[model samples]
Target: MNLHKILIFSSCLFLLPYLNIVLFIEETTSNFYEKYMSMLLVCNFIFSVLFWHNPISKSIIHKIDGFFAKLSVVTVFLYVAFIKDVDPYNENIFFLLYLFFISFARLSNKHSRKEWCSNSHIFYHFLMHLSGIFGGIVAFL
Candidate 1:
């Protein structure tokens, strides 16, 4: 992805977690978990912005971002797994799967051109948005 697309993608990824919190405030009755998750999401957003904006090699930035993104996913999964009142369901499973797919697509699209239909990177980003929304809905349940 170019810098423009990267910025947009980062913004969307940054916003979704907060949107999830706002949209599912009532469901997040567990204050500790909610706060912890929110903090992690915020940190992830900050990391994305900083890594993208820093004057470093694009390849290095991508590597760092990918690593942190995967770390965030694992952190989220562990958080949800250990937390109380979070019922494991198909949606949660799907969310994790979608996240994994997105990560894989991103890693595999290192040399992809920006073709909307054939570009797995763009498709992965689209799927990321959908999964974010789906995960938000699942958060309420």
Candidate 2:
């Protein structure tokens, strides 16, 4: 199938994780603040994916969603490093973030303003979500 169809189909896949998060995550974390923030970050990601078809809204959505996205990663790192008193490096946070960096950089390239982007762009955004989910599962669970 085409990348556009693949991207939309992938968004539906995220819903499973989203439901899992909402249903089971509240009592898992020690900190309520962090738990809610992480949930919001995931929802933002799902919304960004759902709304990505709109060219005019793409940049705006990323601007809003991306802030929370980057913030969530950094916050997760900080929670691991200071609050949990563990070295984030031990968990390979940088390695996880590399995918995010590459994905964001590629998606934000000059071609991003167009109604559509290369297949790589769609794939990278999808990877971004996967990395986020994997990183969260590793760090939190």
TM-score of every prediction relative to native: 0.56, 0.61
Give per-residue CA lDDT, model 1, range 25-98, as digits (tens): 76536476566666656665666666545524446665766676666566555655565456557546646865
Q: Write the per-residue lDDT of candidate 2 for residues 45-131, one digit (tens) a residue.
A: 566565655523446665765676667667766666566544557466744565574565567453345545567666666666666
Model 1 residue 94 CA deviation in Å: 4.1
**Total clashes for model 1:** 0
Which candidate has the highest lDDT of all?
A: 2
> How good is model 2 by TM-score?
0.61
- What lDDT score goes with residue 34 in model 1? 61
Best by TM-score: 2
lDDT of each: 0.55, 0.58
Please give the distance, in angstroms, between residue 95's alpha carbon in candidate 1 and its true position after superposition: 4.6
Off by over 4 Å in 2: 8-29, 55-58, 85-90, 93-116
Q: Candidate 1: where are CA atoms >4 Å away?
A: 1-10, 22-28, 50-64, 82-84, 87-119, 129-133
